[model samples]
Target: MQLTVPDFVGFVGVALVVGTYFLSQMGRMDVRKPLYPGLNGIGAILILYSLSNTFNAASFVIEVFWLVISAAGLIRALLLKSR
Candidate 1:
């Protein structure tokens, strides 16, 4: 088979999301850090972009939620930093 740009984007997105989780699990990264949710939000955006081409309803829905949650985490982190 052939690999397209969207495919590559999706793979990177998946990697970022999974890598972030793995780092958090191993305590290499802090969940409260902006970088954590920042990477997650970026990954979700890339995934959503890839989905625009293939169009999977389930994956799209889940990614949307993931993006939202990541955004909330980022905001919370910023708020805490301000305190």
Candidate 2:
């Protein structure tokens, strides 16, 4: 099977998300930092975009929640910084 642009995008998203997690585990990334959530949000969005062309219920649900959670984390970080 041949890979498409969306597939590449989805792979990049997976890499970003997984890399962030790996960094966090290695103490190179702080979970509370905006960068962490921002990466996650962007990655989730990319994955969602890919999913738009080939939908999967479970994957879609998880990505939706991941995006939502990342958004919440980013918002919380911003609010904290503002205070």
Candidate 3:
């Protein structure tokens, strides 16, 4: 199969998510930091964009929830920082 732009974008999203997890696992990044959820949210959005073209119901649902959860995490982090 040939690679497309959307595919590349999805791959980049995957890389961001995996990279964040790797960093956290290695103690290089904190999961509570804004960057973690930011990366996850961006990654989820990218995946959703790719899914819009491919149209997978399950993947779309999961990505939507993932983005929502990431947003919540980011919001929580910001609120905590402000306090």
Give the number of the best model, judged by lDDT: 1
TM-score of every prediction relative to native: 0.96, 0.95, 0.93
Query: How would you encode candidate 1's per-residue C-alpha lDDT over 1-83 as one tens digit per residue?
Result: 78779978998999999999999999999999889999999999999989877899999999999999999999999888889
Of 2 and 3, the candidate ahead on TM-score is: 2
Question: Could you tell me which 10 consecutive residues in candidate 1 have the lowest summed lDDT?
Answer: 1-10
**Could you tell me which residue pairs clash in candidate 1?**
none
Candidate 2, residue 75: lDDT: 97
Task: Give per-residue lDDT, candidate 2, residue 28.
Answer: 99
Residue 62 C-alpha lDDT in model 1: 98
Q: How much is 53 displaced in model 1, in angstroms?
A: 1.5
Angstrom error of the Cα, residue 36, model 3: value is: 0.5
Error of 1 at 3 (Å): 1.3
Tell me the lDDT of model 2 at 27: 99
Off by over 4 Å in 3: none
Q: Candidate 2 residues 1-83, lDDT tens each?
A: 88889888998999888999999999999998899999999999999988977889999999999999999999998888788
TM-score for candidate 2, please give it.
Answer: 0.95
TM-score order of candidates, top first: 1, 2, 3
Quantify how close model 1 is to the true structure by its C-alpha RMSD in Å. 0.7
